[model samples]
Target: MVSMSKDTPRLDPAAIVTSAMRIADAEGLTAITIRRLAQEHGVTPMALYRHFRDKDDLLDALAARLLADIRLPAPTTAPWDEQIRAVLAACLAVLRPHPAVAGLVPARILLSEPGLTLVERTLALLDEAGFAPDQATEIGSQALCSLVTLVATEPGAATENTDPDTRDDVIRAKRAALRALAPQRYPHILAAADALTLCADRDNYYDLGIEFAVAGIRGIRPATRTSG
Candidate 1:
């Protein structure tokens, strides 16, 4: 380890990124700016620029931070599909807490070391599952994008109000509006009103979303590759 010296740059890149993530979690991606972060750190924008080129660099750093948090499941002799599921789950666990910045994932996944490791592992699993390198690249990208979209677009998730009571009220209002729609022409929608309006159980919502993703991949695999 390099010994600390008084000459060391006062601003830590990791520490600054952590603060930016916190700001994003509370406020929104649009709220993150070099000027704003500089104000938070009591430094001028040029000081922040030393660690980040600009806003885009900082955002990329945030995405790298999310990808770095993934606790990728250990390599196993388990079926490729099963291992892929575990990989997806690990990614979900990281991105769920920082939805605002999760949108940055697809653009940055190949740009970070941790993200590259994950992509490499995922592609290896796809190869084991019989997808050619080109196909695996496409499929892996789609699967990751699907997972990111799932977190970014979950119902009622974008709400600024985190208070449980306030959120419940909002859900109830939405449910009522859906139920109030004329039932004569929308019977199917009417029957599914509650499900349509509220993601009542977040865990189930994500579990089912993951299932949909896995099902799509399984359904598309070559019949000749069937394990059984």
Candidate 2:
């Protein structure tokens, strides 16, 4: 592959984010550095500074791009619970494909237009379901946070590619470790050892969490307003 050099044309902010994402996906977030990006884009490190104030700024831009990739469902007559599930699923779908970027999400500001738009729509859904403004904000924030946590912590979700034998060995090792725990001291854990180490059926696991969140939201009844 031809390497970018200093003689190439100036790199735009979008190009910088794109290159950074590519590096992050191929290697890992740790591989993303201003100097590294500059080298990849055929520009001086100082040129990147012109586009981003610092690494944090560049990461925030990357987060924005990732959020922008989610395609929220259009307004529909679906139940509020279904609406909430749809939004969460859309966000997860985008994050799952770019696990490196997903890990940075908790630290990155979601003030970009696409991010705010998502927040706005989620709150609107809650409001329509009879939740007060404050309640909507709290519940919406918690739901989104829970979804991010799920994606970030999913087993092997962010791991770099590994050959089948190596991957199987890792899984076997984990299962063996879990099984070795004393049943007398950890009865529940011992009983669920197989489920704990199994990485298959992640979609079902994710759906279960979403269902739990939706059920919790439904259980919250809006406060009754009082007037003099």
Best by lDDT: 1
| Residue runs of model 2 more than 4 Å from their true location after superposition | 1-7, 106-110, 158-160, 224-228
RMSD of each: 5.2, 3.1
| Position 72, candidate 2: lDDT | 95
> What does candidate 1's lDDT look like per residue over 156-190, in tens digits?
88664478888788888888988888999888888
Among residues 3 or more apart in sequence or in different chains, the pairs in candidate 2 whose N, CA or C atoms overlap within 3 Å are none
What are the clash counts of all predictions, listed in order?
0, 0
Tens digits of per-residue lDDT for model 2 on 44-74? 7887888899998888998999888989998
Task: List the candidate 1 regions with Cα displacement exceeding 4 Å.
Answer: 1-9, 222-228
Cα deviation in Å at residue 217, candidate 2?
1.1
